[model samples]
Target: MSPARVGRVIRRCVALLLVLGLAGCGDAAAAQTGTVTVFAAASLTESFTTLGRQFEEAHPGNRVVFNFGGSSALATQINEGAPADVFAAAAPANMATVTGAAAPVTFVRNQLVIAVTDGNPKRVTGLAGLTAPGLKVALCAESVPCGAAAATALAAAGVSLTPVTLEQDVKAALAKVRFGEVDAALVYRTDAEASAADVDGIEFPESAKAINDYPIVLLKDAANPGGGQMFIDYVLSADGVRVLTEAGFQAP
Candidate 1:
């Protein structure tokens, strides 16, 4: 073979090898499977956990991981560039913290309720009863969504009572009641329902004025955008709504 012809043949082979290597890289990227991280409100622990498992079951190669905390804290983490696929917040105010997130959708609504020890051991009847002097009370901090809602309800009812402790999230407030550390705590109706076996919920007309809307959105920097969207769609589906309803969340 001529030397020039040999050189041309070698050049073509090198080019072909380069193209094949690039194609292999693309294939590897497409085949990669990763866990989807979800940041959600503390109040969503039970329902979201159940849904996360269902999501993982539906997506065989993918996993669902959750970070549940106060909605405000989760929003802050997302805004600070946390690697999260989805964010489900308990209030619109907290959702607003994350700029550039996909348009948020209101998935459910929640109302504040007074949680007391099981069997009405304290004989607490309504919001007024929580004001009794020396009655230990736990409340979410005013900065958290649940605490803000409690404040709204109290204001609307013309009732003001000092809480013995201010917690960072609804779950913490509920925990106080569950542990018998406080006589009562103001928490979401869903939270109260979740702990029904250990506590009783008291309905008050004031809760109507402080209903909270839960919003969900896909993070702009989601590592698994497709999976995140699928999870969000499932949560908005009829089956998901049924689960939320059973957990005591009102329809949005």
Candidate 2:
């Protein structure tokens, strides 16, 4: 073969190899990026949404999809084979219900409060105030973490009152107060604070008796376990704490 022809063949081989190497790198990068599906408590909606945005910004090509609801309902969904990458529960009891998850870690704490319409139209003052005659109230169902906390706080205060409706999640209960469907609702301080523009969060001493510890874990069958771990790490980081505290969640 001519020397010029041999040099041309060498250049073609080098270019082909470079193209193959770049293609392989692209495939690997694609494999490392996907949506991390997180099943978190309803109370975490606002803060988690904020954190999800930050996470996606920091890790280009990755996304966070959240399924927010009552912790018990979330646990049931995960235990029944729901496809989720992470589980963030409002209480450890709910977290314990899921079987296929890594060891759970308590990330934050939340307390219940009396949520009333803005300006306190009902003149609601404390847990006791919720029992006034002709008052309509809303509480979470007993199975929900917020409801369990409400029961404990009401018991601590020695107050007993029937709610007009029992909501399945903290946000639902808070919505009752926001929409004027009820006079007040016992809900997480974070939830009440998030809707402060439409509702008033009234703190009571009994809340100290029923603080709920929030726990998070990576699901064993997670489609994006690495991304789930990344999110968990971010939640435990200083930035995550700042967001949670700003939303009225206490440090774990």
Candidate 3:
């Protein structure tokens, strides 16, 4: 082979190697961008979404994904080997279901309230009013935190009002009233406030007996442990507290 032709072939091979190395570096950088998955209670929808945006803004390359539903169901999913970086439950009982979580921190507290459609068409004054003939009411199923709280509150008030429908989560119960499917529903105060445009929260005295503590923790099998811890820390931060207060959640 001629010397000039051999030299040209060597140059082409070196250039190809350099390009492949740069491509591998780009792939590695892309892999470093983390995605943190958070499983939270349905009542945290508004507050957590706002916090998620703030978290993304604070950490440029990290993304926050949320799975909002009943706390009990979320815990069950986590225990069943669902991939989750963080777990924020509406009640301790649900959080207890998941083993090997970092020490849970109470972030906020919530209480049940009677959620009625705007203008209170039924003029429902209190729990007793829910018992009025033909007044359709929606309640969370007993399996959920909100439902358990509602049951405790009702029992404390010595009021047993049968609901027309049993929802799986507070959001679902609140939606029933928001959509005019039911005259009223029992949901967290934060949930009612989040949907204030479509529903009105009626604070009842019995709610004091059923306040729920919201606990957040990093999961043992977290894919993005650093991001999860950052998010939990953010929730306990001053700005996060401000957001929770704005959403009508009481400080823990």
Cα RMSD of all models vs. native, in order, equals 6.0, 6.1, 8.7
Error of 3 at 127 (Å): 0.9
TM-score, every prediction: 0.86, 0.88, 0.87
Worst 10 residues of 2 by lDDT: 25-34
Cα distance off (Å), candidate 3, residue 244: 0.6
lDDT of each: 0.91, 0.93, 0.93
lDDT for position 151 in model 1: 95
Pairs with backbone N, CA or C atoms under 3 Å apart (clashes), candidate 2: none
> How many clashes does the backbone of model 2 have?
0
Angstrom error of the Cα, residue 148, model 1: value is 0.5
Runs in model 1 deviating more than 4 A are 1-33
Instruction: Write one digit per residue (lDDT tens) for candidate 2, span 1-252.
Output: 999999999999999999999999988855677899999999999999999999888788899999999999999999899999999999999999999778999999999889999999889999999889999999999999999999999999999999899999999999888888999999988998899899999999999999999999999999988889988998998999999999999998
- Candidates sorted on lDDT, descending: 2, 3, 1
Candidate 1, pairs of clashing residues: none
TM-score of 2: 0.88
